[model samples]
Target: MIDDAPGKGRPTRSRKEAEAARKEQMKRPTGRREQMRRERERRNKLRDKQLAALDGRGDAAYLPARDRGPVRALVRDYIDRRRSVAEYMLPILVVILVLSFIPNPTAVTVVFFLWSVTILSTVVDEIFLVIGLKRELKRRFEPGETKGAVTYGVLRSTQLRRTRRPRPTIERGEPLRDRY
Candidate 1:
């Protein structure tokens, strides 16, 4: 077979030989244990990096795109500096819950109204906050810089401050500088 010339009225390989060659290409498992170990290692590495970033201990390179920019940093600072009514929302909700159980209809009505007002005011406040943030960002940054940031800030503000991930780098009531 090795001495056979290329396709000169004689096929280089028989059909059985070709079929055996094709069958030789099928792969067996490298072993399930090895594959599982490698996959576990990959997941552990990814999870470590992700948790580091979420814990605010990751370096700039590991930080997510949404949290990397100077503008977003400034937005974080601005939101962190001021105390938002929304930040107090959990406590307010507790109060409302307690008030709702009062036997008096008047008490329930009052609590309901209070909750409505709180929700309304929170909406208005968040709207204005986003609007002002947008205007300032437009003035300070080129367009597309602030995209998705308004919603980011708004959602961040609504989260109870203590529970915020990528935890606050600035102290509450910190004076903001015009560094942006």
Candidate 2:
């Protein structure tokens, strides 16, 4: 007959025995699910390292804005609109000049109204460019001192550009263009 003791269904495992079993299972060769779990853990560790590296420097710290599909579309739209204005500027100015020669008062007023709208669009585009630059600069700079000495060193050497010094104008004491 099976034992009917309060602590027994089969033999109850002690805490140490249960822990040892867990360790043994962990040490055993794992299948696909375990491999995936380990891969995920490795990816997380790499992401943490990258984030730590980005936190301290003026330039190295900023991750470029991700190209989310909608955001990319918006950026392309802005660029196209800006380019359209640039391409049309001379033609529009010529039209305005010709319109000024029209003697009718109503035609002059209409030309003036169109010119005002063009000016307003140009101003709005300039404001957007300024705001974008400010945002980009802010993203590139660190908020506070970065962690990890090795990260700081690598970023300084590889990624960060010094503001105070001019870039080298020569390669091997020859003109940079000549070196190529």
Candidate 3:
């Protein structure tokens, strides 16, 4: 007799029956198509999470290695606090673009001159920022602590605060406290 009471062993199907059911299940689209759909859904979710990580919107644990760690966070804060020529570049470019639509040759010449100056100034600022950032990082961190930080700082410096991914956490002109 089968034991149907609590803690009793569950029922089992015969080998032939189990094999037949398995074969039937495999014949349906719910087999391969369902698996592929699940896989695609998983990938889409993972892609969204990764994008959020890139945007600096999620927990620090999910951040990319290039952007992770306290020292890198401090470097980002420092660059964001300072006013950068590169930061103004986007706005100036937009203005120049609008000016380009005017019919006057003088406007075109002015736009060219403005673009040249902005580019030159931004290039010079980026150079100084990289040097200073590297030196400061060296002073504050061990040799091993600063891998890829120079590149990180240079890229961060060029991005405008408003448009930067993983939006700026620290306020503009705010002095960085010794958080390291």
Winning candidate number (TM-score): 1
Q: Give the Cα error of residue 42 in candidate 1, in Å.
A: 2.5
Cα lDDT for residue 165, model 2?
A: 15
Clashing pairs in 3: 55-166
> Ten-residue segment with the worst summed lDDT in candidate 2?
162-171
TM-score of each: 0.70, 0.31, 0.64
> lDDT tens string, model 3, 129-149?
888888878778898988888
Model 1 C-alpha RMSD to native: 9.5
**Clashes per candidate, residues 3 or more apart or on different chains:** 0, 0, 1
Error of 2 at 161 (Å): 30
lDDT of 2 by residue, 52-143 (tens): 43443223223333321222223322232223243354567778889989999998998999799777775565555546533533344342
Rank candidates by lDDT, best first.
Answer: 3, 1, 2
lDDT of 3: 0.82
* Model 3 superposed RMSD (Cα): 9.0
Worst 10 residues of 3 by lDDT: 1-10
